[model samples]
Target chain A: MAVYTQVSAEALAGLLSGYDLGDALSFKGIAEGVQNSNYLLETSRGRFILTLYEHLVDHAALPWFLALTTHFADAGLPVPRPVRDRQGEALQTLLGRPAAIIEFVSGVSVSTPTPAQAQAAGAALGRLHGSAPGFGKARENDLGQPHWPAMAARCLEGAAAIDPQLPALIEAGLRATRDWPAGLPTTEVHTDLFPDNVLMLGDTVTGLIDFYFAATDLVAYDYAVTHAAWCFSADGRDHDPALASALAAGHAGTRGLSADEIAALPQLGVGAALRFTLTRTHDWLNTPADALVTRKDPMAFARRLAWYLKATPNMVLGR
Target chain B: MAVYTQVSAEALAGLLSGYDLGDALSFKGIAEGVQNSNYLLETSRGRFILTLYEHLVDHAALPWFLALTTHFADAGLPVPRPVRDRQGEALQTLLGRPAAIIEFVSGVSVSTPTPAQAQAAGAALGRLHGSAPGFGKARENDLGQPHWPAMAARCLEGAAAIDPQLPALIEAGLRATRDWPAGLPTTEVHTDLFPDNVLMLGDTVTGLIDFYFAATDLVAYDYAVTHAAWCFSADGRDHDPALASALAAGHAGTRGLSADEIAALPQLGVGAALRFTLTRTHDWLNTPADALVTRKDPMAFARRLAWYLKATPNMVLGR
Candidate 1:
């Protein structure tokens, strides 16, 4: 979350005019993320999340968000469809920012999901990928930057700040991630589908949120991203491979993965982790005290890199 | 070099009572680094690097400095051994701090070396590992902490401050490295052997300096470290398989390598790179501008990681 400055209720209320409601009840600033300002909007009609673009959510892509949700809902993939104003505009000017009203998703976040959950995530991803091409025009996810080296740099920077032993680990990362051949598969990917992103009703996944970074990339890439997330704990490392097994199972449920995909999983997992690690780690050192954003340590994702090195078996690795 | 405070010549002379270089000789002050407080020292004795033991190097490990270098020198490898005073102490009390004087090794750092050079580093490492056990006593390189969770937490703390993309990465590293199965092959290893640490003269390998983080670990670990350094240029994402072949050849010339060693080289190369990248990257974010110690950019090592991933063959990356 990268909250900067403040949003007033009056500005928040002004953006609420388009939604179908009995009357405007109350509005409050809810979230200040890296890319957007979110408001918890209430009305006699229902509760909704009004988000103003702040970080990387493109207003140009605002139509994509509105249309994609409508498509997903039509496809029976339960998602909160964005609501347009009376003028049929999906976007509106709110406090000099583009804003949209999205149906509030329901479900508690699953922090420590079971193997079944991992598989579910994988299956959901497969389903999403399988269905995505039908929903929107081809586009790039544009993860913004290369994950590994940037991440490694962030970790090394953190190690220098306080942890001495960590510097060697960073050195180790630089050594291991150095030039070698690894190819990638591109498709539509939800690059950030960790446990926090997925909302669960008991053991089953009910909803997924935070689609600000969703775009076309590798299906294997999503597997790697989910694997890194589901397979690990609070730290960037893992003591269990069950999450991996579950993710594989889920992915397998959707479409049988090839040897190349299996082999590439770990590397992709590393890449995904590195992406988050670098960005979050950067925040840790630079975010202001008043900001709600939290900084992440680069070393956390770096530590898990070794896991990818050993997790995928040789037979499964593409020859 | 993490210099909290600079020590003056008078301050240092006050510490060395018997073997004084006089105030005119060793000019001491704060130097740049995230590791140790380096004071540039010169006298009739020749130019030397005076380092105050910072967070990374412990005062108790002083003997290892003298012992490891002498051991490497005895094994026909050029190592920077610390100079001892008449009191038979390599480290002396200087300004209420522990300090050591080492002969400044002069050589141009290798950016791109021949395949022979990479192999030499491997062979040299094997020889060094073989020689380390001969020391009278073993010293553990206490980087002080190895808790992956804590490391990840730090990343999380800084993530919101610097980059919002970090939380997932921080979590990934913590979870992955937490119970990784590929345990180390304990031997005396140079945990921090980078290109700058390994000096070269006219294509032939002359010396391996900086034993501050030597420990009993995998000999492959050192290969990973040096390979990452020798295999790639400052920035490139694709590693040539030829580099690995050269490394294997050079290493094979010294201590005989196992098939396992050869197979694991590529992955180890990645491991080494990732470790350093994270540490240096983190340091780059947090280190104060006023500090003399220059923070290293983990990005400097990113190209090699990309290269390693691309060029790494499935056979070499064994199950």
Candidate 2:
């Protein structure tokens, strides 16, 4: 939501000299991709997003992210394919930071998506999962169940300041995820497929963006993350049954879920909730008071975890 | 730059329904304006910038700003004209904020401007001053000479924290402007014409933007402000004689300065430097450490003021 780096016109021209994109016509710093500085770059050729990777991005995993998005694009997903320069390089250095240009995908990201949009987003995620087998890359889900205990401990140290109920809710969330299952299904999952990551046009998923959090993880866990993200109210206090049922049906229609995967939905949902809770709690506690970014409330996910602790598989998957 | 407000897709759609620009093909939060939320909005008609007025702006004076830009556009300057709705309204409320769409002007703002570009910028400023007499509107220059003493007093309180010498330098700058010349040429001037405000392609100036500070003021004061903005090194430690001479020659080439405006160059230059020094000092001492905006060094303009305090009219105006 902020441009951390200022790109000069001379530096931009130097960067564009390597590409076939004609003389730069217009360039603007865009407030997107929190971890990187993005510019809406328009050249004689076409519109593209010029991204300068910031410190938060893992430089070693840069190729993997590009390859994953390229794989998705090849499979006909509306992903922004990294544009290669004349020397066939997608990544290079500009202003002492790794930079790349990607095709600009046009679509609106709805904040409060309608049920039809939610179904379309689910279908898009299912397609993403369906296409993962063709790509020959895998990364561990660092935020998965095995890491939750330490994350919970770090958050618990200062969780009292954010909310007095946070420590107890986190402990309860940890207890609920004790039976975290494995081996049901595996795929490269977009672990952060909130509604904002999915672009929509009239209930159709036109683009699935922000693959920075993609990693090899449980299919049910990925589904659980999406369910938790989409089926809840903004405050995360209440669930929308209509949206949940439509989303589940949409995902199931694209790829059939086995009985084991379906049965594990409730526990995976709890784990998903706890994962976000711990991370948000940590962010809320650590983020500087004057940071331009608005810190998302950890209690939102804490409430989601509370709901998932008592929710049955039918309530989760809407079976 | 940062986006202070997030406009949802629904709200954007609702906004577009008022105009005939057709559905929004794409909308992105742009890091352009410091005082407002600007979005690069694309539709079937053309590209435009949708600006949502924020707290720093005076709501009552918005129509005046819009009308002034419209007046500039009408006078053939490369200013973005406000787009009107079916009912001929450019200013409206979106998400409880005043918002409007302006025509998108194309060109890049150079950080290290060439001497030729500096001359062109001066010519653009000259054209702006030349075009002003035709327009029938006047607003007090809120950031002009009259406002500096109070601004300097406020900045002096905490100037030591920034630099020990700043307070003395501010006092000296105040003394230099104590006999500030009056009864000079006056017009509607863009009081803040930094390099970023003037967009260019090669030596040709295509756009003169950011008129938030435009008000009726001495024509020489405006020139002095621009001269201070463009003819100095990034650190303000050194001046570019070629750039200074070219900028003055260019402006004079377009609109000849009187002997009084020419002789007042040194004093007005000192005043301009002091004005920016005070503002930047106030911002530096007051801006929260966690604020996303980088607080510009007030010392940069302090150094400029120091130079102007000793510089002769020939050194400043390149006689």
Candidate 3:
């Protein structure tokens, strides 16, 4: 939620000359994406979001992200379509960084979503998965199981400072997921569909954003991540079971979870909680003290991990 | 260029219900104003800027600021008009702070202005002064001459850390402005018409923003402030004399400067440089180490002061 890079007017004008977009009327650095500098660009053509990929984001993976979003938009999903320049390039270089002008998707991201909204979000996720099979280019989930132990170890190093009991709980979660259900419906999954990433217009899920984390992963695991994100309260200790049930019902209506997928939901839920807790913990500890972006509380996901430890598949299914 | 407050979707929806602006389609925190939290809000009606007044702003003085812009917009000036609610009140409370929905003005703010752009900006400033006589309300410039010495003293306390020569330079500037000319063509002045506050469409000045610093002061002083703002280069030492002359000519074309006002230009320019240097010095010294907004270099204005020290009124008038 900070614009790290400053784009000059002359530089922006030079970049826009290659495009059909009319002369730049207004350009403002906006507090939107965390890993990129976003400008709310208005031209004679229309309003668009000009994004400059920051160092934190892997430049090599940008084309894949852009392609996935283009595919989703082409499939009629409410995703931001990358605008191509006159030379027919959607992704190009600007200020020596990979940049793109994206059609601005309109909708407000709800911090606290209602059950109906959560269900709609789940249905949208199902639709997103349904549209992904034809996208041949694949990217590995960098923050997946292979990276979890290392993140957990890093968190454990400073766990006592955050919460004395956090390390033990994280260790237990790792032990529980050691032989987690293997090869259960691999598909393109939005691994970070937190409430902030899902845009809402009343009860309808109008848009899903931040596909930078999208990768080929277990279809059930994607639902599990959303469950943890939408169902849990701000503190993460409590969750609305009805919201979880609604989300499952919504996904089932579209994709219909298999028996193995259904059985693996609880384990996936625990893994999902662990994933976020470790990442948030790392971010909370490492974010520069003076950075304008606020570090999210890791304890919220810590409490979610605690709840998932006692949760069963039946509990998640609201049986 | 920072959003200090976060307004939730529910709170925003509740606020918009009081207005006729339909529903919010998109709302994003934009990096615009430094003193307030500004959001680029797109509603069913049109695009608007939502500003939440931070603690630094005096709430009592808000109506005056709103009315001044309203007056300017009413008189065909390119200023953002404060949108009134159903009850015809532009000033309202949102999220426990004084907030307003301002009509979004088009055009980009230029960091470096061309001579033509500077002239247009100066003409706009003159137009702003010309429209001010009937505005009944008057607010004193809080950062005016009376406060300069105190601010300079504060800056002097920590000046050595920034630059060893800064204290002597600031002290010299203070002594030079001690018996400065007073009571020369007083009117409502946009005390801080820095290049960033003036918006330009090509060579034409399309908008004037951030009127929070608007107050009753010497109209010549306003021009001096702008001269210092628009004429200086990035390093602040080198200035385009032709740009200064163009700005003076543009202002003279709108509301002719009096003989005494013309004579006092050099002194006012030095004072203007000192005023900004002191405040910016204070801000630079006190800004939190990890703050997202980068502090403006005070040395830039200090260099402006150095230039103003040797400047004569004729030098500013291009005679």
Q: Which candidate is the best by TM-score?
A: 3
Candidate 1 structure quality by residue, lDDT tens digits, B1-319: 2244456434555554555443324242322334666655555556566777765556677676667776777767777667777787777766666777776654434545666666666677667767766764665634312533444444455554543444444444344334432654556778776655666554555668778778755677676676676665555444555666676666667764566665566555555555654565566667765443445555555444444444444323221
For every model in order, what is the number of clashing pairs? 137, 0, 1
Docking class of 2: medium
Give residue A95's error in model 2 in angstroms: 2.3
* Candidate 3 C-alpha lDDT tens digits along B1-319: 7888899898899999999999989989998777899999999899999999998888889999999999999999999999999999999898799999999988888877878888898899889888888787778989887778888877798987887778888998889889867667777779999888987889888889999989988888888898888887877878888898888888888886889988888888889999988888898899889766688988898898888888888887756
Model 2, A2-73: lDDT tens digits are 887899999999999899998778889999867899999888899999999998888778888888999999
What pairs collide in candidate 3? A290-B290
lDDT string for model 3 (A1-319, tens) is 8888888777888999999999889889898878999999999888899999998888888888998999999999888899999989999898899999999878998887887888888888889878888887778999887778888888788877888877887888798787878878888889988888988788887788888889988888888898899898898978788888888777877775789988888788889988988888888788888776788877788788888778888778655
Per-residue accuracy of model 2 over B1-319 as CA lDDT, tens digit each: 7887899899999999999999877889999877899999988899899999988888888888899999999999988899999999999999899999999988899999988999899888898899998787889888888888988888798998898999999999999998879889898999899999988877888888888888889999999999999999977899998999889888988885898998899999999999999999998988878766778999999999999999888888755
TM-score of chain B of each: 0.77, 0.98, 0.97
lDDT of 1 by residue, A257-276 (tens): 67777656655554565566
- Stretches of candidate 3 off by over 4 Å are none
Give the poorly placed runs of model 1, Cα more than 4 Å off.
Answer: A1-9, A31-34, A56-61, A144-159, A162-185, A313-319, B1-319
TM-score of 3: 0.98
Per-model TM-score, in order, reads 0.45, 0.97, 0.98
